[model samples]
Target: MEKEEYLDLYYQMVLIRRVEEAAAQLYQQGKIGGFLHLYIGQEAVSTGLISARQPQDRVITAYRDHGVAINCGIPAKKVMAELLGKTTGVSKGKGGSMHMADVSKNFWGGHAIVGAHLPLAAGLALGDQYLENDAITICMFGDGATNIGYFHEALNLSKVWNLPVLWVCENNRYGMGTAVERASAVSEIRQKAEGYCIPNDCVDGMDVLKVRQAAEEAIRFVRQNNSPFFLEIETYRFRGHSMGDPERYRKPEEVKKWEENDPIGIYRNHLIAKQIASEEELDLLDEKATKETAEAVQFAETSPEPPPEALFEHVYADVS
Candidate 1:
């Protein structure tokens, strides 16, 4: 990647991180509500993968979705307002934190149900293939969802039907406090794909370049073969599973150990070592991101709440 490309990727990651941090603060302050899941440490996975997609391509994921929406070009203020249940929200205040969708950009949603989105993504791929549009559907999920039967079913069908989709598992060690080791028969998530004859690989989710490279290769393979592929991105989440948990499931040292591989820090060092950017330039980017987040909060704060009468709209179709 060129220096400019690296800088853009860094900027996107910073934007996601800052937007999520601001969302956490809003939830704490009672401005945002209803099952808030912060994507503090998993920004690289979404940012890198989404960067490789075309505008017409679609993205669907599990509940930890703020980063995906932001990376896919949803305005920060709109997302914040959606979380706050305000009229100006992305889903018009109906979807909250887990159901952000911007169809104009082909960002399907932030589905909350564990593995429900997988089949929906497969259907999306089918649509693309039927229409002969070379677009791909990127389905992302957590390690916890890997154990669910829907994932396997979706993969098998997509592979057999030669659907253009990439099943990306963000293996963040724990699935709402239950570690993958405790939840699954075998801890190696990618290896599970061999049974279905789907091509599979693992990538370091924390490293943006690695994630990008892996996604690019998978996307290319899917385009060439018009088949499904599987990727397990081993990542970590720094914050508690949600706003409610005390997070007593893991030891502090474990969290610290993962922090040692902080994606942001690693990428920053790589840029500097490669002479792509200097510390000062990165700091400026941080400052800019902080400011942008602050502005989004202000916008959400001032935005009007949805009108009570609007509740009847966008529901059942009008029958004349």
Candidate 2:
């Protein structure tokens, strides 16, 4: 990667981390409502994978989707507003944290139901193929979601149709409270794709460079053969599944172990070691991200709530 690219990736990761941290803080302060899923440690997976996509390409993911939305060009302020249930929100305050959608940017939505979005992603790919567009659809989900019946159905259909879709399983070791081993009979997520005769691989989801390489390869394959592919990104989430989770299921030391391999810290050290960014420059980056997050929060707070009549406005389509 070029020096500028490395710097931009660092900035993107920092922005995602700071925004999610701020959202969590707001939720705790009662400023933001609804289910809040923080993508604290899984920054590399989204940043790396989404960076590989073209502007015209579409993305869909499960509820832990704030990072993807931001990566897809949605403003941080609008995302925070959505989490706060304000009118300025991406979903116009109707979808809250778990359902942010910006059709203009082609970020379809943040679906709350596990594995439910897979088929939708395949359908999106089908549309692109039918139109003779070269766009690819990247469908993301948690490791737990891989066990759902819809996942199997979606994969089968995607493979049968040879749709240009990449099924990414962000295997963060655990699904909600249940460990992957406990929840899945076959824990090898990548192998699951073979049943549908789709090519697959496992990626180091914590390393942005590794993720980018893997995603690029997958994208190339899907575009070349017009076939669906699957990737199991072996990553970890720093926070509990949700705000309410006490996380008694995992030990503190286990969390600390993953923290040591944090994508942000690892990338920062790599950049400095390679003389790409000075310590002062890195500090400035942190400062900038912090300030940006603060400004986004202020914007969300000052933005007006959705008008009472807006409830019915977006709900019903124009029939006349």
Candidate 3:
């Protein structure tokens, strides 16, 4: 890849890491309420794949969505504001952390239900297909969502109709507190797509370049053939399922092992090895991300809270 592309990927990954870290701090300090899911270790998955999407392509995902929205071009301040339930948020502070939606950016939403967004993703693809548009839809979900019935139904429907969609499974090995072995009959999540006749591949989720390559191929396949494709990225979450999770299911050694393969560190080393960037340059990039994240926090803190009367505004739609 070109130098600028490498720099862009690295920068975005750093931005996401900083943003999540800031969010965690804010949540602990009681500045942000709600069940916060931190995307600390899964940075490469969203950064690489979402960055590969076209302008008209739409993205939908389960509750772990701040990273996806950021990668889709939603301002970091707006995401932070939404997390803080500020009126300036993307969802007008209504969606909070688990329900950020930027229709203008084509980021459909961060659906709170386990596997519910899968069908909505298919519907988006179907609409594009019916309109004869070349745009595609990318649906991202965790391994836990795969076990849900909607996952299978959506994939089957997409396959039958030949809708342009990409199903991306961020297999982080545990669903809530249950390990994949304990939860899934077949631990290899990519194999599930075979039942729906969708071509699928598994990539090292810790590697940004690898994820980007797989994303490019998946996007190409869906767009060219007007069909669905699946990608199961083997990654791990450094944090618990949620902020208060006791995390008794996995050992500390396992977490340590994965931390050694940390995506940001790996990519930083790759850039240095390729002579594309220096350690100093990368550090500067990290500083930039940190600065930006602090600014986002400031923006969120000062943003106004939604009024009580405003609650009924978006609750219902005007059919007329």
Among all windows of ten consecutive residues in candidate 2, which has the lowest summed lDDT?
A: 311-320
> Looking at candidate 2, what is the lDDT of residue 217?
92
Clashing residue pairs in all predictions, respectively, total 1, 0, 0
Candidate 3: give the clashing pairs: none
lDDT of each: 0.89, 0.92, 0.93
TM-score, candidate 3, is 0.98
Per-model TM against the reference: 0.97, 0.98, 0.98
Greater-TM-score candidate between 1 and 3:
3
Off by over 4 Å in 1: 317-319
lDDT of 3 at 175: 91
List where candidate 3 sits over 4 angstroms from the true fold: none
lDDT tens digits by residue: candidate 3, 1-320? 78888998999888988998999999999988989998889999999998789999999999999988899899999999999999999998988899999999999989999999999999999999999998999999999999999999999999999999999999999999998988888999998999888999999999999999999999999999989999999999999998999989999999999999999999999999989999999899999999999999999999888998987786668755
For the record, the alpha-carbon RMSD of candidate 1 to the native fold, in angstroms, is 1.1
lDDT of 2: 0.92
